[model samples]
Target: MWISTSFFMMLHIPLRTETTSLMSSGKTLRKGVRKMKREILYPELTTLYGDGGNMLLLKQCCNDAVFRETGLEEVPWFVSEDVDFICIGSMSEPKQLLVREKLKPYKERIRELIEKGTVFLVTGNAMELFGQYIEDRKERMEMLGIFDYHAQRNLDKRLNYIVLAQYEKLPVVGVKSQFSQIHGLDNHHFLKMVKGLGDNEGSEFEGIHYRNFFGTYCLGPLLVYNPQFTKHLLELCGQKGEIVFEKELEEAYYERLRKYRHPDSPVVLGHGFI
Candidate 1:
């Protein structure tokens, strides 16, 4: 039986709050899971900073996946059909506005899918589209309002960081490169910052994790850099196959983790403009 979306909201327990809790709640796929045919939706205009690699990772992991791509003018496949996963990458600041406008019409459907536990991975600034608004020195642009958060954008300055965060027992490492910082996120954060700035300079949390929807500023090659997390994701999608390059990916992940753990490693905050 499918769980009701309002029930989860009323309880205030996000589906992917923590690994242990998630497992205990029986929301995750169990051990010895079998492969299932997955339909993946890839929407257009969110490709930037090599974030498109997220989709490639999914395709590589799920051999029986059926992939669909939609342009800005075209209606997304998920609007009419049920999709197992939806992945969107980073895009330019101008493109963000366009994409937001294009997706505004389907905001309710997106929210419903997220509540139903359809896996969604929105990386980099693409995540901001689901928020309340994006404000800059020039003007304020309204967003989807699926979440209460808002973003502050500064076109002049860019913030760069190599973040090391913990998600339950897993170590998550990624690059955060953005001209904007998110605000108003509290309970539904995706990662706990162990050594880096999050959402903004004052915040300790990074990204959004509501139900199976994962929205983050961590840009580029996220899946390739974290094999364990990828494996977990495959399991979440009902696949329990071997990762394409498990050994090599784990080596790279641990090496990066080692470097990130060092005291001297830098989390560069360029200009510190919010």
Candidate 2:
């Protein structure tokens, strides 16, 4: 089932039998274990950094709730036939260029899938290329334009911890690190913001939201520290039923959050890439 508020969208997916059995078994299963719902990570041309942790957390969350998680790499690879969610992680400028080159050939298909209401959670620089254009130091490159907004490198870099106010009744918290500014769209409403948009871009323009796509600048493996937001994303991916918080998983999330609460927190930089 799908649930939506003015600023946020939620999807609830029913648990499958195989997934429940695996969780109940208490066995150490490999990464790619049960298969039911489809979840893809665009890893071919992107440097995910801590986004892998985000995906893992989501998988574990689903497992706790008795739902299956599958990852898709190449286009031709098997994708569980029914994709519930598609997540793209943060990428460096060079890696993004390479991924875009590979994706250029499949632009039409990608656009079609996005328009079909496929749940997409894009973070950091990965979202820049999904828009009209990205302005880098060297030159300006055309993007997928799936979103109406445009991204341009800002003269100053924005790096700080944020406390986003509740939007549509869901609490959101994430860090922001970007040298880019988004413009050209006014109709679309942002989820919410409680901190910096760099040079004070404006209130209603902190983030981007259109259809089932959600783009944000939150860096440090966002979903891991934000279970409420993660659960909301899963709901958008067709997750149906009660959102029962798993004790172990919830503890793990809070532990990580405590480590990364402050901007100067040691956990912030130790994770390699942000």
Candidate 3:
């Protein structure tokens, strides 16, 4: 089930029956299953972008797979630990700087984890900051320097739209909005390009991939349009056990995809960022 709020443009998505049942059953049988821990680090100081819906989507996805389907326990680690997957969402420039300061201590640890093949899903400015630096004219700050790139903010225009692609056999959908131009990237590969922000300037640099890290500028409540990507992510997190998909879940997900794919869908419109 899902509900929408016009004021915040937020959508409330409920856990499917199979997911709820699995989580309930898994809690009862926690003794035998291997657990997976995923972390979502939100910088409180940063102004959230992308409808602020990605975390909810991620939680629901993980709950369905690890907690609901396979009955595997899951945990959230924010301060830095052995995280199987780490997601960094979009935030405003000032807020991003604050987060950069907060994350300074964990830079080495984050690098280590990524080298071990841990998945990192960095969206919006989060992806931009992983590069060398971000210059806002008034202030210039260094980022985590995880990826081999640089981001320079542009006040001229903001790009916003829905994105379509396939990565590692999983279909994905997302929205893009940023004024930053990325450069200094030496080696990287793109998974796919469909509608919005393809490679770079709709030509190249659409998406970036290095090892297990996936970075994109897409925002449009990304996960809601890309359940297949979520499934693959969970599989990478070690929840590949056999399971049956409930009809309700499938129906809900596909319906969302259809709606978003429409040329005139409300969610597909620009939110003043373009």
Candidate 4:
């Protein structure tokens, strides 16, 4: 039901509709400069599965965006300054704990930022931070507890799904493949899962969407597969920017979505002890 910039996203990428302008290095601009600020957390470790493209997508989508980033030891500037967007992408399980610990000190600040309209896109394992805790067998890992969900790592069965959901009038699509599943937001969900598992296979619902917080397990460089969603983000921030390589991006997105929509598409599921 949803198609606009999305029709272009389905086209497939030799164009890298996702990897456009990438900005970083804590560069400060003029005080009166009205550029949108976007911050990425621990890119070195969390850029797995091409999720780094999300940052590039944002940089290009928001031409005035002054992109900044933080390392594991550095405090995120969003804690003290205004930022339009904050991104935390995919990382391994061990690194997840490390990042969680680094973020623990900023709980109150994160809460405040959420209230003030700072959008956060926490994808893959990074979403564990927003939950109350994550359990791997008998061991338990505490999380930020911003949302009521509790994540449980599936040591035996990792799930991989081709996600298709509806966001307003747009038909949202992405890939959801992970070892941990979250539960708790039965009533409040990101979208109605039309196909494939959402938070978990048992749940028909997927993700959690609040004022500006968008947490999901979907990968496939979500923004790359869904450019319309990126545009929606700009609108949510009250900002405007143009999509780079629209024609090529559209073609790439179409090619990729075609493969995904195929009934006999190839599946990539890993078997690991994590």
Model 4: residues >4 Å from true position, as ranges?
A: 1-33, 255-274
Stronger candidate by lDDT (1 vs 3): 1
TM-score of 2: 0.68
Q: What TM value does model 3 have?
A: 0.73
Tell me the deviation in Å of residue 150 in model 1.
0.3
Which is the better candidate, 2 or 4, if ranked by lDDT?
4
Segments in model 1 whose C-alpha atoms lie over 4 Å from true places: 1-44, 269-274
- What do the candidate models score in CA lDDT, each in turn? 0.74, 0.56, 0.59, 0.74
Residues 1-274, model 1: lDDT tens digits: 1112332233342211111323334455457754343433334456566565555556555655556666666777788877777878888788887888778788899989889998888888888899999999989999999999999999887888887998778999878888899999978999999987699989989999898888889853677667788888777777787886577667778888898899998877454311
Worst 10 residues of 4 by lDDT: 13-22
TM-score of 4: 0.83
Candidate 2, residues 1-274, lDDT tens digits: the string is 1111211211132222124434554755567754445444454433254555565555545542333332223552223244556667787666767767656766766677667776777877787777789875778888877777788775456444443434467655555656677776565554555443521365444556677777776655666556667777777865554333444335655555454455655322222233
lDDT of 4 at 192: 78
Worst 10 residues of 3 by lDDT: 67-76
Give lDDT tens digits, candidate 4, residues 52-127: 7777666656655666777777878787789888999999888988898889999989988988878999888888
lDDT (C-alpha) at residue 247 in model 2:
47
